[model samples]
Target: MQTIPAGNYLIVFNENGVREINNLIERNRYSSIFLICDENSHEHCVPAFLSEIETEIKIEIIEIEAGEELKNITTCVDIWSTLAEMGADRKSLIINVGGGVISDIGGFIAATFKRGIDFINVPTTLLAMVDASVGGKNGVDLGHLKNQI
Candidate 1:
């Protein structure tokens, strides 16, 4: 397996990465688990992910519409609200599955919610796999502009 260290976490590649995920989850003993996925990843990747995770942890899947247009403060608010409703505390873990949009916004939500929770990104597209899913950078656009601070 290819392991690229990114800050506190490792960006792992290869089929064995699933085993790595299981190991991380087991080691962390997170209070709860939340998965963020766009429509594409929800359909394409969640099943494979679910199969790979051997532990029977209670996982809540959050789905957002797939598109850059949905990446905004409104989406973040919805995600934050969902986490609150689902009782996600400081010890919860957020797994972001999908392309760059899911990873970026999911990371943002995880970082801000409950004053920061642990999150991992599983990129499902070439662009995201190469760029957005690694390096721990995440942000949303400001209206028509892109990557606005």
Candidate 2:
């Protein structure tokens, strides 16, 4: 496992980690829950995640094209547009549930929407789990440059 910088995050490790997700959501009691994922992740992981959250909480799943090329301002615009169309407001919580590209772009969209909202990262790929999401590092790539904030 990668080491997240000290005091920047709260680490929780469990064999049944997904179970913790629902409990975490309950504890925070966000107004709404939005799940961000790629097409592949939607097909592969989303069902299981949804199954874990048996609560009656409002949940919105947003799926984008799975690729590094899709990580950009345009994608953020699309996600924000979706959020608007879905009636997602500042109180909604964004849960990123894919690889690095999805997490990076989704986090950016959530961070900027309505001057920022709550977000959680559930990275499926090894690279994302090992590197990207763990460090509080986030942002989409700009042409040849990988930007993080």
Candidate 3:
């Protein structure tokens, strides 16, 4: 896979995305792996995602409710607390695997928790895939307004 450098992270392409994800897992030695997904993605995307990843590090699945209605400060706080309770540290890695809601909230959680940890988005839907492929767009809605928080 060809890695296109983007700021502090790298985007893997030109090969099987999942295979590259496996390679990345092999390369990094994280203390723990956190896979954050909505309930839907947890059912549809996670099995394949878990199978492709060959990591011995414990993977904690943090499943959240889907939809924009859930993408708020409440959800962020819940996920933040969950990360703390799940033993996430500075060296821990977060993998967001779901749609736009996952990408937005997941990135926000990863960026804020513990003064920022590493996170990679494995977007499931077409909208999410397009959204995650780009860099540096992360925020949760503030009430009815989008990207407000």
Candidate 4:
């Protein structure tokens, strides 16, 4: 029931957050919805996430492999390509549903795609809630280097 305002978005709790998200969707009139999650979240979190969203617009699930090694430019490129192939445009909204890797990479893709589309970070872990989702630092690693893109 708690709501924390973050810029244009409100970081809310549980199923209650979905209501505010629906309000956002109504206000934005996004052409489509992109739910970006890793394998773990897709399996665990996405079912609950999808059930609460009340929208007529098509929702696409973009599931990525779960691992730090997968959080690189190559993966970003693949996802970007997927977004394009799936008809993602400037009016699309990307909802990142997972922890750090998903928040970081998915946010990065949303920020850069079509010169930045709107995105929401639904951090499902303490690390993501305190760090990645709030950090506003998005980019990918170059091998062992962090955030080097």
- For the record, the alpha-carbon RMSD of candidate 3 to the native fold, in angstroms, is 1.4
Candidate RMSDs in order: 1.1, 2.5, 1.4, 1.7
Global lDDT of each model?
A: 0.88, 0.81, 0.87, 0.90
By TM-score, the candidates rank as: 1, 3, 4, 2
- For residue 59, model 4's alpha carbon misses the true position, in angstroms, by 0.7
Candidate 3 per-residue lDDT, tens place, 1-149, comes to: 57788888777766468777767777877899999999999999899889878778878999998888999999999999999998999989999999999998899998899999988888889988777536868999898999987
How well is each residue in 89-133 modelled by candidate 2, as lDDT tens digits?
888889999988987887788778999888888889999887766
Query: Candidate 3 or 4, higher lDDT?
Result: 4
**Relative to the unseen true structure, what is the C-alpha lDDT of residue 95 in candidate 4, on a scale of 0 to 100?**
95
List ranges where model 1 is wrong by over 4 Å: none
- For candidate 1, the per-residue lDDT at 90 reads 97
Per-residue error at 53 for model 2, in Å?
A: 1.0
- Kindly list the per-residue Cα lDDT of model 4 for residues 70-148, writing each as its tens digit: 9999999999999999999999999999999999999999999999999998888999998898846787889999889
Between prediction 1 and prediction 4, the one with superior lDDT is: 4
Greater TM-score among 2 and 4 belongs to 4
What's model 3's TM-score? 0.93
Give the least accurate 10-residue stretch of model 4, judged by summed lDDT. Answer: 6-15
